[model samples]
Target: MPAQVICIGSVLWDIVGRTPRNMALSNDVPGRILRLPGGVALNIAQALAKYDLSPVALTAIGQDTEGDDLMKASADLGLDMQFVHRPDDLPTDCYMAIEGANGLIAAIADAHSLEAAGDAILAPLTDGRLGSETSPFSGVIALDGNLTLALLQEIAQNPLFSNADLRIAPASPGKAERLRPFLTHSRGTLYVNLEEAGILVDRLFDSSQDAVRALLDAGAARVMVTHGGRDATFGTPDLITSQTPPKVNVTRITGAGDTFMAAHIAAEIQGASPSDALNAALAAAASYVSGDTILS
Candidate 1:
């Protein structure tokens, strides 16, 4: 089937170590480690697939054995991988994170291969395979901040994305500023946490409501801000909606934001109102963090 959505950015393995006890600096604890197919774009794509949306993942994967395994794993999740750029030079990227009961202690993202691949992965979008300059892709597009600043800037202004419904997210707080270019995109909706929103605006926000309103005032077309287990708000210039996520034990913190974004997108596409969509997203995210949703 043709693609209903396009997920662009890092696509690789996620090695996460989760421990039940709270941890602090220089502390090592016994935990379970799982290597899963992840990355902001891939996570969102996987969630979209579960919603019956055919998503095409556009990113770089090396020709190494890890890349081969990752491709097979992603295909098994119902993602369209035919348009991915597979170069023989770079090795598949990976992200490692240590999550304790308190939260994410530290993480390292080895996405150099994706950064080096750059705009090459987007060739299919402009080469008539999915779309061209004259006939651009008008479907829903999920983008992540794992890309270099230059490429993200180009996409913010590129006509190829002008007609698409863009949903942008930062891969992590460290990469949050990379999404600055799309702050004013007419059709873009940013999914960010309270800290990530503060990074983009350069000011600390007290709550999701404050952050969402501040982002709208700062020229963002639309935005969704989540403040951990507090509350999440979705806002536009004229209207704003808020939803408090159901409280649950957060056993894992890795893909919660991506799940929220994907669930919101799916709800909106199914003609849900903005308020209902926010609720649905928060519910899905709560399930993910509570370890109630199984990852394939």
Candidate 2:
């Protein structure tokens, strides 16, 4: 497959309210607040862009001022922003989160706009620009479970993605089950954490290696399971490999997993072996979690 342009699942801005100190309960703390173009899809696509890969975002942002600003941001990042469906009545989607020194305490994703827009965001892919159902875009496609379950199921069944190299991540641990449809996809590669992998396999795994094995047994074509501050596992149809993440002081953790996924894809696309890919991803994620790398 030609691996030029990749499409990330759903794109939107993230409004993050973060504090330096950790708190146990819902005690409001004052700290730096930031709003950026984020989402599992956008973050992964942005990281891919850093590697000089042109990525198109298949997402819905509303036809509003926020959406306009988001489009400008996407363009500035050198992303292909066409096919971002905007409905007149729907407002642009957003994700709001609170992060402390520990990790992300809570998050609310308002992606109703994308859900309403449905497959309209994929119009370009189905048209001549990218690919259609007949001659599908056989490129690297990064998918996320931020999409509705039904849409994911449809994508799993769609011939347009049947031939593409699929690298997928669940938007969150709670959404991991939504990726079940792609478990059997011939070309799907799953990037998941131990918790998410356990969710998919409907069991508990004491180690990343165990999680990787369980995921492979559950029918994933390829699997990578990350354990924070522990060993991360990578697997092909025949072999499974492991790499330990470099130890670092964890400053933040919101986009760390997404960074790892992007780095993994970029490594493989650059012809790295599974061990090399996992190592690259681990280094990238370690730097990101240590707040050494910018923009995930």
Candidate 3:
């Protein structure tokens, strides 16, 4: 049976501006600019599709023209999006970014709509559509930190996730601290970068291994910390391992982490061991970042 995945978090469009040449402040160079559907949950869901998970998104978007178009784009991709909440007053969220040859230059995210929607997006779970507090949704759930701290705490303590296997990703370093609530959850697996891992562990880490160890010691059952192009560490109850990511020509910087998270979750759902899952995740992320145009 295909693993049932509930992707809970933001769903929005990303506008990225790229430059082939190295850049800095006041440097204006010509490069390709593209727009695509991207958000923590949406990105993971899209990447999970590649692994045949067909995740259903639990998110909210506005009823604006852009929102309609983005929904159409999603439908074209065959994402099972029955859980998305559409509000008339709210405007769909969007993110914009600029990237140079060196790396990411600047980025701005406008996810206020999602933040304002709050637990309303999770109606399915509360209203017995997805699951309830009494009988929570089972199967794998890719949870994001884009949710408010209150909601995160609720999820951590609520019975809704008592039977669910959770794969979590912090939407960004700013909100990474929100996941601290889940440190004690038995079913949680954290996928984070070095800096964000430090936020959760409340200290600085010298290496990926250090971060993973600290997070594991701080009550996380399993932790995977990625140090950019450096070695990625996986720490679990049984073992700790590290794997280097294959070098790839960097075309874009966004969505790479989500790609890794999604692939890892899918691999685990398919019964891959931790080491095998990490390797598969790195390979999928390398392929995703190396080039655009992932041919289905």
Candidate 4:
């Protein structure tokens, strides 16, 4: 399939440990452990693929066993890997997370390889291959904050991105500050959770609506703020819309935000109204967390 969008950031293996009971520090419980292909960009891409949107990955992977396996997995999921950067010297990246009944306990992302690969990962966009500054790729680009802050900053002002519709994700709250540059990009839209929005705005917001306003005030062109089990809001300088996510038992939380972001993007691409898009995204996320098969 041809690429409908480009996903730029970490493409790695996810080692997840999930338990049905609440857990604390040093608490070991019966749980399920699984290894899956995951990353901010990959998660969003996988979800997009579910909507039959082919996304091309533009991240660095290694030439090792893990990288080979990840490539096969991404292919099986229908992601376009032809543009992915694979360096022989760098080892494959990975993320480990433990989720308990209450919520996420901890996560560690080993994305040093991605950061080290640097601008090399973006060569395809600049080398007159997939696209170039003279003829920029004028499609949607899903970017994750796993890339270094310097690269993110460059991308914010780079002419190569001038014509693209950019969708940015902070990857995690710890990396939220890295998205500062994109806040001012005219065509960029940020997908963040309540805490991530607070980190970006330097203030605590009591609700997603408040966070949406704060983010727009902080110079973000557009923002979507989601609060776990609460209302989520999408805001622009001129309009703000809020909707409650459908109530569901959250059996997992790792990739719910990405699912919401992907679903929303898909809905908009298919010409859904803003209200319909938000409802579709919320419904998809609710289904994801409820461990149901997402049909959207």
**TM-score of structure candidate 3:** 0.96
lDDT of 2 by residue, 209-292 (tens): 999888888888898898899999998779999988888988877788888998988898999988998899999988988888
Q: Score each candidate by Cα lDDT.
A: 0.93, 0.83, 0.85, 0.91
Which candidate number has the best lDDT?
Answer: 1
Tens-place lDDT digits, model 3, residues 25-126? 989899988888888888888887778776889988889999998887776665677778999999999989899878889888888888899888888987
Model 2: weakest 10-residue lDDT segment is: 1-10
Alpha-carbon RMSD to native, per candidate: 1.2, 1.8, 1.6, 1.5
In model 4, the Cα lDDT at residue 158 comes to: 94
Residue runs of model 3 more than 4 Å from their true location after superposition: 184-187, 292-296
Better of 3 and 4 by TM-score: 4
Candidate 4 stretches with Cα past 4 Å from truth are: 1-3
Clash pairs (backbone) in predicted model 4: none
- lDDT ranking, high to low: 1, 4, 3, 2
lDDT of 1 by residue, 205-246 (tens): 989999998888888899999999998999999999988899
Clashes of 3: 0
Candidates 1 and 2 compared by lDDT, better number: 1
